[model samples]
Target: MTTPGEGWKTPELRAAEAQVDARFKQAQDLANRLRDTPLPPVPPVDFAAIARQVERAAQERDAPEQLKALKRKVDAGEFTWEDVVSGKAAQDPDVQAMQQENVNKMKQAFQMLREGMAADEIMAAQDPRRHRDDGDENPPDVFTEDKW
Candidate 1:
């Protein structure tokens, strides 16, 4: 719509101006398309996963032989955490002796209990001298001369 001069233009000039205007409009359309179109999305980054990968790579680099040996054993089914076993545990003689003593005491107690049940007496009539049925409350202590 804007002209450079006030004078009337010839046919070729007008045609040339129209061609230039069309090309300018085409260029503007291309510019608009480029501005309006969306760009491709960028993928999300996983820093933690990257860090773990780096750590594993470093460990493998540092101990390649050990890792390979372990892998070989695993692949051949020669080793397993469940299959690992402990040797016979060492027993202390003192502890074994104590256990035997306790076992003997328990056996004696059970025998005494069985005898009491057969005789209808819960106790073996608790040694007569150890517990007296006398009505005396206080008994005199006969101390030695040194204790006195």
Candidate 2:
């Protein structure tokens, strides 16, 4: 049987292998240091200060031109009672209750819309071509069949 080449046991090859092992050990030590090191605490966000800044900005802003552009629409009766009622201008208790009610209605509408879209995707997945079965029966109707 022929012996393996002498280069396999050469000084350079052995040095390269030792260098790789040393680099791996260094990487492990770095990882351990990072894992043990405590991260700096995050500073708290000042929402009240941000709100004051926003209020100040809005008060100082030159919005007359923007308001002037909308003045025509306001004068032309394009702005309806419902439009203003949905905004912050209507801040009474009754208006707040109405806003909450409208928000609930919108949430329900969006949830139904999402469920309908999901149902369509599920119905498409149930198509026979999507997966092959060993002559098994169709899957149960989730809507029609109730566990209760």
Candidate 3:
């Protein structure tokens, strides 16, 4: 090993430095060649035309599949054109039942509100924690003044 203050002029170091200098010269020559070469001009793109072509191709590919699905639904008696036009095709029986249940619950809630029941009373009545068995004749009064 060389001393800290010694110049780095050992034979091995000189050989390494020469190799690096040769590599640098080669890289510079490549850069010069690249700079001297002429590049081809880029043509302008028509994005709208490309988008239209893609949309047309997609429509062509998807049309038969969509028609087949519609035909299957019609054959199964699951849909009609009148249902589609009336926006009722989306509402199946399960969806209708759920909507009706919700409406009934809302009506009951409104009736309770009109009868001067507090919101907390309504919520407490609906709370799972307060659930009782059908055999229990009298459910506990959630609105009792002493409970609070």
Candidate 4:
């Protein structure tokens, strides 16, 4: 009956194994020493306070440029409460331009809808192959064909 260590009986191999064991023991001892060492105390964190500050900063950072400009104008007292209430503040060139753009987009969408309905009607009337029953035809069998 042969043993597992029978092939490792050589003196050179034994010496190599001893060296590896010694290095492993040294590494374990170092790890144990590090585990016993004292660490610096960590300051207590206020997570809720940090989260609130982060949210406020993000809201400020993510505000739109136009909104920021409006805020600046309001803060500078360029317009009175009556101007805002009476819709005079909305008469700013930028606001007017944006409203005009929205109106133009709505007009274009109505035009597209009208043109699309006309096109669909024309296609349905003219095209004979619009909705044919494809399942009526038999599919070609590759096994029966000799062209391959």
Local distance difference test, each candidate: 0.50, 0.52, 0.58, 0.56
lDDT of 1 by residue, 32-53 (tens): 9999999999997655565455
Candidate 2 structure quality by residue, lDDT tens digits, 2-43 = 246755576777778788999999999999999999999999
Candidate topping lDDT: 3
**Whole-structure CA lDDT of model 3:** 0.58
lDDT by residue (50-96, candidate 3, tens digit) is 54553353344333343344445645778653443344654665334
What is the TM-score (0 to 1) of candidate 1? 0.25
The pairs that clash in candidate 2 are none
Candidate 4 segments whose C-alpha is farther than 4 A from its true place: 1-4, 7-16, 61-148
Q: After superposing candidate 2, which stretches have Cα over 4 Å from the reference?
A: 1-9, 45-148
lDDT string, candidate 4, 1-148, tens digits: 2358678477777788788999999999999999999999998765556545533432564444544454455557876433433457778764455446557756755676677756554444443334344532223332333434
RMSD to the hidden true structure, all candidates:
37.2, 22.9, 25.9, 27.8
